[model samples]
Target: MTTINYISAVTQALEEEMERDEGVFVLGEDVGARGGVFRATEGLYERFGEERVLDTPLAESAIAGVGIGAAMYGMRPVAEMQFADFIFPAVNQIVSEAAKIRYRSNNDWEVPLTIRAPYGGGIHGALYHSQSVEAMFSSIPGLKVVIPSTPYDVKGLLKAAIRDNDPVLFFEHKKAYRLIKGEVPEGDDYTVPIGKADVKREGDDVTVITYGLCVHFALQAAEKLQEEGISTHILDLRTIYPMDRTGVVEAARRTGKVLLVTEDTKEGSVLNEAAAAIAEECLFDLDSPIERLAAPDVPAMPYAPPLEKTFMMNEDKVESAIRELAHF
Candidate 1:
């Protein structure tokens, strides 16, 4: 096993997949020489050359449209959106074309396309660069949404998404890019299933379900909660759309207390589905009312450091909420 950060895991996954499959290629603005805005594609341009590692104009719609076209033509294309906020320009291509190709054509055609975007707050990207766009796309049918919390998980899930027969929206938390690290296998190639959830920590007091950066905060909160005898069972809904309902039910049943967490606004958060599933199947099993922790209904993240903190969910806020639920 090799220790690496979340962003490096992305690069590793791309390199391994490209090596394994000649059809796999990457495209985005500045992906050629700048190695991506966050260096997630560092050295890929040099290794893959201009033909495979394409550098496109600053156009999100064009990027998604071209990738979709390639996928439909039997090529595996990995398209990067500079930031999740910028992806709005390509919503039509993503939601209409790439997402509906297989179903609209009666399963004869498949768009094995992977859309990667760096998302979430805490980097002072202000409003444009720090939006949580996953919640918007999670409800779309025929499209798979994947958000990985750890380096190992990200690498495996990315490989799985790249090879899958359907289009996948892979949202990488920009903050977690460098903040989260884990031991990943080096000699072997592996892929994590897209629809499965992972139990990051096991406890009996309360079940905290989340994804992306919230998973890291929940894990950290669990460590501190253990000191107070408030054991926390943390479930990372790695794939929020076709969420692991069975895992949610089982985890909720295990502790009988549930706390749903996300970086998106609470109104239509993806965790809403998890909460509904628990309510529908595990309501009686719950010891307390299902709770959700998320950002306020603010328009977007603010540039001011203090306002950003207020709009973001972190370890301290998560711990306090988990602790309250544990004692309830």
Candidate 2:
């Protein structure tokens, strides 16, 4: 095992996949020369050359369109959207083409493509750069959505997504890219399957279900809760689309109480979906109403530190929710 950063894990996944499968390649803005805006693709251009690692125009639509067309031909393409917010321009291609191609055509053709992007608030990225758009794609039927909170999960889930025959939207929390570090299994063959929720921390008082940056936040809160004699279980929904509902239900049953947390706005958020699933599958086991702690529906992320802090969910908020649920 080797200790690596989240960005390094992602780069390793791409490089290994490219070596394993000739059809696996990367395309996006500044991917070939600049090695991506966040340097996630650094050193790739030199090894893979310009043909496999392409630098495209600034248009997201054009970049996504190319990936869709290539995937139709059975080539596994990983398209990088510079920022998660910028992916809006490619919504039609994602929802209408890449996502529905397999189902709409009755499995005759499948888009084995992965759309990679850095997301979430923090680092003072302001409104444009910091956004959690997972809910948008989670609502879609044909897309597989994944958000990894650690270097280990980032590497394993990315490889699994690449090998899968369906379209995947991979969200890399910008904050976790550098701040989070963990031991990733060595070698190129290691892979973690999609739709598995990891039990990040074990507890019996209450369960905190989340993904992305919130997973780390929930764990931090769980640590503090432990000190206060409130055992808080933390479940990281690593792959949100094909959600591990069974795992979530089991956690809830073990804890008897639930608190859902996420960086996205609470309204119609992915956490809400998880809570709803728990209610449907494990209502009899619930000791209290599932509490959801998330960002309020503000117009956009604020530039000021104080406002931005209030707009995002943190350890304090997560702990408060856990206390209420555990005592309810």
Candidate 3:
């Protein structure tokens, strides 16, 4: 096992996949020559050549549309949106065409396309650069959404998403792309199945369910809470769609308190689903009402660093909620 940064893990996955499969290709604005907006796809263009690693024009809609077409022809395409906020322009292709192709035509045609985007705020991305739109895609069926918090998960899940028959919206937290590090087994193509949650940290007092950048935050809060004698069970749901209800329920049952955390706005957020699941399935086991610590429903992230810090959820908020819920 070797430790690698999140961005390196992503690059490794793509490199491995491209080497393994002849039909797998990557296309996006600045992906080929510029090596992605965040350099996640850095060095791929030179290694894989222009045909396999393409750089398209500044049209997200056209990029997604071309990806869908390519996928229908049995070519797996990973299309990257420079930022998650910009994916809205390709919603028609993602929602109407890519997502529903297999189901709409009675399994005649399927899109094995993966839409990759860097999501979440915290690195001063401000309004347009930072947004967590997983819930929007979550509401729509037939689209698999993945938000990986760690380098290991990012590598495994990206490989899985590339091979999956359905269209997958893979959301990578930009903040986590460099912040988090973990050991990933070196080697050929390895894949972690979607719809499974990995136990990030095992404990008994409560379960902190989270993904993306906040998983690290939750782990940090759990560590601090441990010093205060609060044991937290952390569940990292690598894939949001086809959620690992079994894993979440088991954790909720073991630790009666559940804190759902995300960078997305709390109102109409994905946390609602996780909280409701606990309430519905493990209501009798829960010692307190389900609590959520998420980004406030602000239209845009503040430019000031201090204001941004207050706007986003962090370790202190999770710790406070954990203490309150544990004692409730």
Candidate 4:
């Protein structure tokens, strides 16, 4: 076991996977020489050489297009988007082409590609740098959406994403890149299965379901509520698309109350989807109305630090919401 930050864990996963499989290569803006905008791909170019680690043009569409073409031709490509907000330009290739290739070809073709990007607010990235795009891509079929909150989960899930047979959109919270730290297994084969939710904190009073950086806030709130005799269960939905319905339903049923949280705007967010699922499956078990804590539906993130703070979900907000739901 090794204690590492989220960014190092991601770099380790890419290095190990590339070493294990010769076909696995990485490409993106400034990924080769600059080692990525956030250094998530640092030291990879020196280790794997220029051929395997490529620095593509600034165009997002071309990056997605090249990744899809390479994946269909038997190479595993890990394409990085400088920021999650910039991935919009590649939607045509990602949604219309890479996502539908397998079904369109009658299972004759599979796009074993992973699109990695840093997302979420809290670093004061503002506007174009701090947008959450999970819901946009998760709604599409033939795609897996993954957002890891900790170093361990990021490393393991990234490896799983690289080895999977389908296309995956992997979102890493920008704030968590260095802020979150944990012990990761010191091996190349360690992998966390996709579509499974891990209970970060076990409780009985309320179940707080969340993902990405919100998982850390939920855990913090859970810890504080414990001092007041309120047990809050926190479930981190690492993989958003193939959501762990059974785990979500079970947590809701076990606690008899639920509080869904997300950093994205509330409307049509992943929290809404989870709340709807729990409402349908565990309606009888619910003791209180499902509460969702998310950012307001606004045009874009504010550049001001104070306004950004109000726009993002934090431990204080999470704790207040949990207290309300626990009392309900």
Candidate 5:
């Protein structure tokens, strides 16, 4: 076991996967020579050489396009979008081409591609850089959206994403890269299966459903609520799209209250889907109305620290919401 930060865990996954499979290679602007904007790809270029660690032009569409092409031709390509907000330029290729190729061809071709991006707020990335984009892609079929909160989940799910026979959108919360650290397996064969949710904290009072950096906040809120005799169960939905419906229903059944949290804006957020599932399957199990904690329907993340703090999701907000639901 190794105690590493989220960024190092990501680097370890890339390195181990590249070493395990000759077909796996990484490409993006500054990834090769600059070790990526966040240094998640640090030292990979020197170890893997230029051919495997490619540096492409400042084009998100081209990067995604080439990655899809490479995957279609039997190569496992991990492409990086400098920031999750910038990935919009490549949405055409991602949603239209890579996502539909396998189904459109009737299992004839598979796009074994992993698109990684640093997402969410708390690093002062402002409007242009800080955006929770999981909701945008989670609605698309044939694509897996993964947002891992811990080092262990990040490394394992990333490796699993790379090995999967379909395109996976892996979002690493920018704030969690260095903030979140935990023990990850040292073995090369370890993998956390995709489409499964882990119950971080087992409780009976209320169930908190969340992902990404918000999972950490939910844990913190759970700990605080535990002090007041309110047991909070946290369900970390590691894979967003192929969501763990069973996990969602079970958690809601275990507890009578449900609190859905996400960093994405409230309008058309991923939490909406989770809440809907709970409403449909576990409505009888719920004692109170389902509560959702998320950013307001704002145009973009504010630049001012005060406004951004309000826009961002935090433990205080989560704790307050849980407390309210517990009483209701």
Candidate 6:
């Protein structure tokens, strides 16, 4: 096993995939030379060369459209959005074309494209650079949304995303690039299957369900709460769209208490869908009402430090929520 940071795991996954498959290529703004806006693609250009590691114009739509076209022709294209906030321009291309290609074509075409974007807050990236975009695309039928919380899963899920025979939106928390690290198996084909929730920590008093950076925050909060006799069962919804209903239901049933945490706004967030599932499947088993702790319903995250802290959810907030829910 090798211990690596989140960003290095991303670089490792890209390098391994490109080396493993000849058809796998990467394209996005500043991906080739600049090594991605966050350096997630650093050193890949030098190793893979220009043809395989492409740097396209700053056009998100074109990036998705071109990747979709390549995927249709049997090439696996990984398209990167400089920031999750700037992915709006590519929504039409991703949602309409890449998502519906296989279904619309009646299984005649397969868009094996993976879109990678750094998401979530905590680095003071503020409104423009920091945002959780998984919620927007998670409800879309054909697009699989994945948000990995650890270095190990980052490598595995990304490889799985590239190999998937459909469009996948893989969101990495910029906050966790270096902050989160874990031991990953140092070998090939270390891919974690999508659509499954991971049990990060197991407890019986209350269940904290979340994804992305929130998973790390909740785990920290769980440790603090354990001293107070509140044992939290943490579930990381690694893939939001094709949610692990079985896992969500099982976790909810185990504790009889649920607290959904996320960095996105409370309204129409991923937790809302999760809350519905718990209510539908494990309503009778729940001891308390499903509670949620998330960012405020502001237009966007504020740039000011004070305002950003207020808008962002953290370990303290998670612990407080878990403590309260455990008492309920």
For all candidates in order, the CA lDDT equals 0.94, 0.90, 0.88, 0.93, 0.94, 0.93
lDDT of 1 by residue, 130-193 (tens): 9999988988998999999999999999999999999999999999999888999987899999
Q: lDDT, candidate 6, residue 170? A: 96
In candidate 3 the C-alpha lDDT for residue 120 amounts to 83
lDDT of 5 by residue, 140-246 (tens): 99999999999999999999999999999999999999999999877856889999999999999999999999999999988988899999999999999988999
lDDT at position 27, candidate 4: 97
Model 3 alpha-carbon drift over 4 Å, by segment: none
> What TM-score against the true fold does each predicted structure earn?
0.99, 0.98, 0.98, 0.99, 0.99, 0.99
| Model 5 worst lDDT run, 10 consecutive residues | 183-192
For model 1, where is the 10-residue window of minimal lDDT? 278-287
Error of 3 at 198 (Å): 1.3
Worst 10 residues of 6 by lDDT: 119-128
Tens digits of lDDT, candidate 3, 1-328? 8999999998999999999899999999999988998999999999999999999998999999999999999999999999989998999999999889988999999999999999888888788877889999887889999999888888999999999998999999888888889999977457899999889999998888988888888889889988989898999988887688888888889888888888889898887878877888888998877888888888977778999888877778888887787777
The sequence of per-residue lDDT tens digits that candidate 4 reaches over residues 137-176 is 8888999999998999999999999999999999999999
lDDT of 2: 0.90
Error of 2 at 7 (Å): 0.9
- Model 2 ranges with Cα > 4 A deviation: none
Which whole-number lDDT from 0 to 100 does residue 305 have in model 4?
A: 95
Q: Which residue segments of model 4 deviate by more than 4 Å?
A: none
